[model samples]
Target: MNERPSRHVIRPSGCPGLLRVVQALDGGICRIKLDGGSIQADQAEAVALVAERFAGGVIEATNRANLQVRGIGPERDALIESLLAAGLGPRNPAGDDVRNLMLSPSAGIDRRMLIDTRPLAEQILTTLQTHERFHELSAKFAVQLDGAEALAMLEHHHDLWLSALVRDGEPWLAFGFAGVPLDEPAGRVPLAQGHALVVAVLELFLDLARPDQNRMRELLAEFSADEFVTLLARRVPLQPCPDWRRVASTDGLHIGIHPQHDDGVFVGAVVPLGRLDAAMLRGAARLAREKGDGSLRFTPWQSLLLPNVRADNAAGVLARLQALGLLVSGDQPLAQLIACTGSSGCAKAMADTKADAHQLAERLHRRGQALNIHLSGCPRSCAAAHIAPATLLAVAPGRYDLYFRDATLPGFGALQAHNLTIEALDHWLDAHPRSPLDA
Candidate 1:
């Protein structure tokens, strides 16, 4: 195991990293960023072990496809060291916080992928970590590389987004700034120049953005996209792509058996409320070793996928995942519900959102309704990246204000009701089965 480095070497940030454990209402939070959302089985076991030994055994699969161990005690160094030994730490300690890149969980394996994005993703990730200039980026500054996978998370916005495209029978990447792949792209680059395009964009952002402008959107607010693209053209070759728009990804593929590009299949299951116990993770790792490839991939939807399982063993894998306490079917109400760490773990939270979500899930299940609902403890809406069809924002313990997503509105969208109890909210939802809120 590598020796623990001095505390000064770690960056000062409110966010948690492997080398920097930030204090929380529950305990310390140490986030382990995975490469392209992939982790080997042995590394996962190491996470489970240290979580059980040094923390409360409460592990979270974050919305960004990373794992964080919560409720950690003072043995923070030991936990971090163990994870580093398992190969979870960044290439250098200084690079940890800047390593924010999102790729489709099925990057290489997705059957509908236009190109395998793993290789380019690796190149981009390494540059993000090792390039000292890139380290100046805010911890939240992120990039997304999409292989045009059918299982992609296309809704989450990023500082920069690149999606695979084919023109004239040759693969190219269509990229945009401060938006999702679904947005119209700024330009296209040859597949071989994808890495250069990413580098050029980041360097230009650093050169142009003010100290206060930590995100691309913030910078773009001051400078127009067209103007920025015009400037970017001087750094790298750019091609017009006015006609390109990313296709929307299919949903529910993250919670069931799905075929990969090869003959094998991948099984996916949701971690309940985005929280998992050590046993659950260990069990999943064991399944990955026995029935699938010796690796697991996490998705932005807070789910885990075990890829390369034999087609015949897919059913057994799903059954075992269900036994491990993961929601295996999208129809399960818990699978559709997401909740943030509420009063139990976040000082900013007004109520125990996780507990309330469980109650809400049971009520929805009893009504045979599996609606996409987000239970946020506060306005930050940390539980969801995209607005859900329905949302319940906590106002007090056991009380919430309901909102239905409206493209015409902002925040959690139009608030439909205020300060209703869980039971009352349940009845309200049932009463509006035919409403657009239920769509």
Candidate 2:
């Protein structure tokens, strides 16, 4: 007989974990963090099954490339057991919350990748989970390892980032603290020392940070990044990384068929509003098993990639995904819009952002315009890790404050309009055709 999954004492946090199901307006939510966003078809099916059997059949593709099962009932332990049986749980119960590492969905497959980050990522992940001290780290404390992939999510800020770079015909990792990979690196280390450097940084952080200082950005607020780097050098050898800036990644690589460095192609499709019904997930898993490599890689854009699909079979896979109601094209207005679980699932939500998003998409499609828009139920901006080009902040039911992302302005950027209905907002967006909202 298979042993029952050991239930661990749930920790106190707003975030959910595989073992820690946080209660939401919809019910309990269990977050399953994938290693490098990759899940086998069998495992994906397991998730689908549990979502249908124990939850309300709602699966979310999170911005970090993880999956969450929402609307879970009292059978939380049974649901956790099912996921743990599928090998989706953390190495240890205590380690679940600390495994907040992000990787490029196209890690080893991207044609533009300079290094295969999988090996290093595995090493870092193993350390993060097995190192008991790391459990002290905050659940939201995240790290990003970029392999110079064209399909990478470079805009999302991380507590620590190591981006692959070539120096003197050798691969090196450009390191930065409390920022995205696009920022100027604080220093560089040999690719081989990448894991050691990460260990050193985390240890240094834990030693220097107070109990209240959980994130690197918070610690940096009190201590200078340069000073911290100066201290880190004594622990890990580092080299100057002056004039090194990560090249801008190509946009929209998360959707549609994209060529891999290898012979096979990757078929990408975005989940409508980051949601997948049980049927949609099972269909995708079946497609992965039949046409692709039998594995699915979720993307930070709330999309999933059927990697290693034959170039010839890519079209068929994409067509099947579209038939399943997934958005396969970036040009579709619905594909460009993202909304958080609003009043339906979140107590903090003032408006039904998802319903509003659907209305906005229809209007934008009618105008033949597709702009990246984020609809937040509140100011927390839980759905998006980075700022979208345009944001609609809900103030009241069916009414929102509009803002366009500005280089200079803070939180949700510069306000453009206040408390406009979806219809009025659509008119404003149509009138400002060439505004940053369009970008």
Candidate 3:
């Protein structure tokens, strides 16, 4: 047998990686960060097999478009070895934690994409993993490369964000920091300089940020964005883009069959509460192999997309996915709900968020309403990277405080009701059917 590459020592962090399994209430968790969430069919099957053999068969599709195996046993090393053999490990061991780049699951295939982000994403990802200096970045420090795809996750804020644009009939990338692409860009760079811009921004951040300031927002709080951008200009050419703003992405495009830029179509399905079993994964992999391209792309919506499918085969693929116990329709109440690993898995949780979300879904479904709601076990908001239209924060077992998303307010928006049970919350929603909170 070939010897495995020696694991490099990484900075201390609470987050899990393929080489670092963090203990949770359920067991250990090992996160497998995919390049733009793309996973080959056979590689996915290997993941399923290892999850069943070494963990509790619980595989979760994270909000960051990554997968994690929960309830791992003492055979953690074996599980890691299996995944590594399947080519899921980082290019370099130390690169694992810093591989926090997000791309639209429909990056290359989206009909509305301005440019194919895969090539640029590849360059950035390689630099992130192989560049030794970048290893000092916080595990949560992330970057987003937007191709202006209709199905992009534009709400999730990142340390740095780049969105493709066209200026004077030439391709350019509008860039910003400490926000999403929807925000007005601080500057623009030529398309060919996208990779250089990313490298310069990261290097500048590392140089200026204090040891205590690990995130871009933290550094910006001390050093103004204008000041940072001024220094960045010295590293790379920057063009003012004061009037440039990214277009809003269409919601629910991540859930049904969507047409690609080419003749092929992509079928998407929601993984209930972001949790999947070994069987569900294996089945999806098989379908990907048979009906679509031999790969699956997970999404920031905690869903998976089977891309490159023939238009005629899209419906059948969707149906097969549904048979695997995945939610293929937006009307499914669970498809609109997201929950964290509550008391059932996380020690910090005050309640079993997953079970409560299920109960809430049933109530909403019976009422013929499918609203986008997030159920968080605690203030950490592990389930959602972006604020949902409505948030239910747990205060005690079966009780939560409801908040409505108000652009004017911060941190889960304005809190509306405090400590209401799942049943009472259902009643509250029923009472306010016409309110914006209905979303």
Listed per candidate, the RMSD to the true structure in angstroms reads: 2.0, 2.5, 2.4
By summed lDDT, the worst window of 10 consecutive residues in model 1 runs over 1-10
All candidates' lDDT scores? 0.92, 0.93, 0.92
Residues 1-439 of candidate 1: C-alpha lDDT, one tens digit per residue:
2223465287677888899888888988999999999999999999999999999999999999999999999888888888988999999778999899999999998999999999998999999999999999999999999999999998888999999999999999999999999998999999999999999999999999998999999999989999999999999999999898888999988989999998899999999999999999999999999998899999999999999999999999999999999999988999999899999999999999998989988998898878888999999998788888888899988899999888899888988899988899877877777876476
TM-score of 2: 0.98
Query: Model 3, residue 187: what's the lDDT?
Result: 95
- Candidate 3 achieves a global lDDT of 0.92
> What's model 1's overall lDDT?
0.92
TM-score for each predicted model, relative to the true structure? 0.98, 0.98, 0.97
lDDT of 2 by residue, 55-140 (tens): 99999999999999999998888999889899999888888998888999999999999999999999999999999889889999
User: Tens digits of per-residue lDDT for model 3 on 1-439?
Assistant: 1122245455567888998888898888999999999999999999999999999999999999999999998888898989999999999988999999999999999999999999999999999999999999999999999998999999899999999999889999999999999998999999999999999999999999899998999999889999998999999999999788788999898888989999899999999999999999999999999999899999999999999999999999999889999999999999999999999999999999999999999998898988889999899998899989999999999999999888998799998899999889878877877877553
Model 3 vs truth, CA RMSD: 2.4
RMSD of 2: 2.5
